[model samples]
Target: MEHPAALAGPPIGWRDLDRVLVVRPDNLGDVLMAGPALRALRHAAPGARLDLLAAPAGAAAALLLPEIDAVLTCSVSWQEAGSRDVPVAADLDLVDRIGHGGYQAVVILTSFSQSPWPAGYLCRLAGVPVRVGMSKEFGGAGLTHWVPSPPDELHQVDRSLHLLERVAVPPFGGRLHARVPPGAVRAARVLLGDRGPYALILPGASCPARRYPAGRFARVAGRLASSGLRVVVAGTAKEAPVVAEAAGDVPGAVILAGELDVPALAATVAGARVVVCNNSGGAHLAAALGTPVVVLFAGTEQVGQYLPRFVPASVLTVPTGCAPCRQFTCPYALECLDLPPERVAAEAVRLAARGPVRTSAWSSVREPG
Candidate 1:
């Protein structure tokens, strides 16, 4: 493995790298959206060992990505909202680990709402020679390759691809990718107890601001059941209560919250006729599995940016005058929740009837909004 110092140019290319550490310390949805960029890095440097430094929420998704050779977990204070202060010991430990990993380059991935300067500084502290990130902050001092942030209207996946371009890694498939092992699929099938087609409803989000109302989800589940589709409510253990509320006495509805892991959840989404979820990780996982999705998006302003574009999805939002507030708590009103259950159920039913969407004509299959 040639060291960065051994390379002649100030900015080294993929040929000069033997191993790269890609840092995406955020939630599951964020990591899933980085799939295309990860693939691009792998495609460009096929022999280079690609590793991921992910947050706990995103660790499982990182492990599931075939392109990643290793996964490291790091819960940063800036990435998670309202968390404890930065753990100085943990931060130093991470820096020490990266310094010892013999990495040639460290690529820090961040969302439009986040600044990558902090992660880049950490890499620099670890003595990583080639530090790269997308940033407009910190005067771009720490980054060897500071890619300017793209337009806000760009989708999260597209933004990641743009960032990877700083290292000359082009977009690979321009799509989301995930892996659900056959064993996980079998386990999920057993949990379902029946082979009949079912509609998956993810009724929880990482933040309350992004979640649809529980009652509305229940009504939608009932409507789907009434239409002869089995409803399956799935979420994490922490979200079990919300999932149970959403599954509310809907005939033929099964509540599997807290029972499935990420891979199993992916398998469940892949097996479903369609997925109805909040603007959360479930929607991204469904998109990766090629399942049609109906998203009850509570944040209208950033819909074009966060929502997955590579899948057939119907995004339902009220389009409030002050939409895209990007606030955890709505000040005036929760206008986005006004998306009627009837409308959402109609969209889900329509997509279910169409079954899984396999073609790349995503625009033709999905609604413009």
Candidate 2:
């Protein structure tokens, strides 16, 4: 596969693109990864109106982005290859919604394995004059323009940005930025009053294998609290019990699991002294907020695609011989993240004291077990 860098060049000009729809209908981290690309698009076409189409779960992070003009929720569901066909009304409703938007250009961002076929088809049906996306899919053949998708190893943020390179959009030192509205910041202050600087422990991931042991997290929180840093456990409503259990018996440790919405969550992450999290959405959120992160990676996924990309972050990965299998279901028990609770706590303390640790030394460091 050719590198996206090899294809980088000048920006393409569109004649009359008053309204542009940027499509990334996926997870929170995926939407955040598209931030740089969206910023680039806005910079490339300042006059064009930009709207984001995303899932409801990802809408909060999308709303925190300053570059997006509006966020429209996309609830379309299409079955996988072996599943039954979607109902006609659902398909027609989706098409009608897209058509009603009246966008001139549509940019579709997708993972390498996942085709943008349905989205591309919808855009074409909506009468979008100029449709642009990666040309890997048979359905993408209908697009007005197509660029090749990046290799699997490439970081998702860079991959999304590379799509713009095909159309000649120049890179301008893009960094991820998640804004906290004034009200959200005030709300965070109220929620965490006089707790001083605290470390955030995020113990949830979309995939089970990527998550570290909750008991280990609780032990780490206890140790960090002992070391004089308040530990706050943060998660969504679904992960409330995990967060609460992880913060067990620690005096200054509190669980803000179900308390925050997206903007407030961004604000809370922004104010944190350090964030310890899995290779999950909150990890990406902390990175976007420019907070220091200690990201734990199990053997189930690739470090390059999901690890935090900020300068002052450390990725802790345990290398087994069968590492980087990228499986959602670990065939063997999850031995990769089964580090001793004391060791995990010590590492968290080290991360808190040393500021941001660089990955430059990672090549020399031995893999943990």
Candidate 3:
């Protein structure tokens, strides 16, 4: 692969690059929402080896994206000051690893609420030539392509795509994606074995601020079971208690919390007739797999920015005056998510009746707030 000019231009199109590292060091939902932007990067730099630098929370989603050629993960302790814990050896090691990767360009994707300079500083330390990011904060010499921070109204997908325009990667607004590995496919097949046509209920709490009552989730599961669809509940090992509560006493309901890895979970979601989840990662995964989704949305975050994308989706949310408060702790006890089980179940059943859409292609679906 040819090396980039030592002092390259800011618009040194990703297509001309030999290697590029895309950075999204955040949650699963964040990475999943960045799918369209990653797809844009792949198109812009078809010949360039597109690698990813992800946090432990996002690496699973990064690995599931077929656009990425490789993935590197690190749990950099992001401090309250919007910077990494530089004293940690793991962060330094990441800098060293990135330094050796020979990446000509590094495109950093951050949420509207995050600081990109922390990731940019690491790229700068690694001596990467063309660093790109969007930041409201001044990036100084750390970033070669500094996009002005986008409007908060932009969805996560659009925000990342907006940043990519700085480096000349376009063709925005596409569907979410997840590529299930053969191993994960096998694992999921074994786990679900012959459980025909199930409704997947992911009752795990991705964020305390956005969680729906587990009891209501169990009711939704029971509702689906009554409609002749078997139920499968998924959650992380850490979410076992929540999963157990949501799977409680439901006839033929399968508890899969802690039993499947991210990719296997993706596979399971891919096979589901429909998915019932909170405003969380599973909803994004379902969006990626083109599985219809029902989101028990809380108004803490902008519903437009984070709701499931592309596939058929039902957003069940109560109106709140303090909608999009952006607070992780609800002082009002999450009143925005005060949807009844029957209503949530009705929406889930409605989407389930439509069944899942099977396509890996990106989409141009859009919704107005």
Candidate 4:
């Protein structure tokens, strides 16, 4: 690899650079959305060793992506204030590890409003010559190539891939793909032995507004079971009680909570007839696996921005006057997800019958104020 000064002009056009590190220290859904950008970088520089730096929870998704040659867990704590708590010791250790790896370039992926300071500082501290990221703040001082942020309405995947235009062009509306390891598939089979096809319901989200009521999910599950569809409640340990309560007394309704990792979850979702979930990480994972997804959006987050990107998927939104507010908290109660269980069950039944749904008519109904 040539030194930064030895290269002509900027290192953006150089194809000979062999090692690159991509940093996306965000949540599971954001990390999954970064797959296309990673693939684009790998496609552009096939010989380049690709390393991913992400939060601990995002490590599983990063490990599953075939484009990444290595995965590094970041110790920085992220908060809704958009501030990063970079541990000094961990930062220094990561810097030393990256410095020793001899990376030629680094790409930092971030939203328009969030500062890429931590990533930029890390790249600089690690002595990586060519750093690429959007020029939102700091005036591109630390970046070798500063790409423009996409318009607000752009999908997260598109926004991430837009920065990669400096290296390569990706397909328009690129699909999100996650590989389910064979072991995970086997585990899913073992977990669901002789159960046959079942509908997986993920009723929890990190945000309160994004979560549909557990009682509503239970009602829907019971109705689905009565209609001859087996219901399986799936979620993390924090969501165990919620899923268990939702799956109550429905004879064949099983609660598979806290049993699988991301890849295993993907496999489990892949084997399912369909997935009904809140606007959460599991929804994105199910979409990536090409499984039919019924995502319930709370009208707080932008549906166009965070909704599942699968071909045949349904997005159920309330479309109230306060739709797309993207609020983390709701003061007057979350009416967005206050739909009747019968209606939700009907939609899920339709989805289960018709393979995968393309659009959502459920969003048309009005909710009482």
Residue-level lDDT of model 4, residues 254-338, one tens digit each, is 7888998887787777766678888888788877877777888898767787777754688887778887666777766678887
How high a TM-score does candidate 3 get? 0.89
Give per-residue CA lDDT, model 1, range 1-369, as digits (tens).
333322122655786578999999888898898899989888887889999999898889975688999987878655757756767887888889889888889888887778877787878899888887876454345677777777778888888888777556778767887877767766877888654678899998877888898888999999999987889999999998999999989976889879999988888888788899998999898888788899888864488887766677898888777777878877766777788899999999998888644332121122113
- Model 3 residue 183 CA deviation in Å: 2.5
C-alpha lDDT of all candidate models, in order: 0.81, 0.75, 0.81, 0.74
- The best candidate in terms of TM-score: 1
For candidate 3, what is the lDDT?
Answer: 0.81
- Residue 165 lDDT (model 1): 70
- Residue 179's lDDT within candidate 2 is 66
- Per-residue CA lDDT of model 3 for 80-113, tens digit only, reads 3344445678678988999999999998888888
- RMSD in Å for candidate 3, one decimal? 6.2
TM-score winner between 2 and 3, please give it: 3
Candidate order, TM-score descending = 1, 3, 2, 4
**True-structure lDDT of candidate 2:** 0.75
TM-score of every model versus the real structure: 0.91, 0.88, 0.89, 0.87
**Which segments of model 3 are wrong by more than 4 Å?**
1-9, 79-88, 356-369
> Which residue pairs come into collision in candidate 2?
10-168, 11-168, 12-167
Pick the winner on lDDT between candidates 1 and 2.
Answer: 1
Model 3, position 334, has a per-residue lDDT of 82
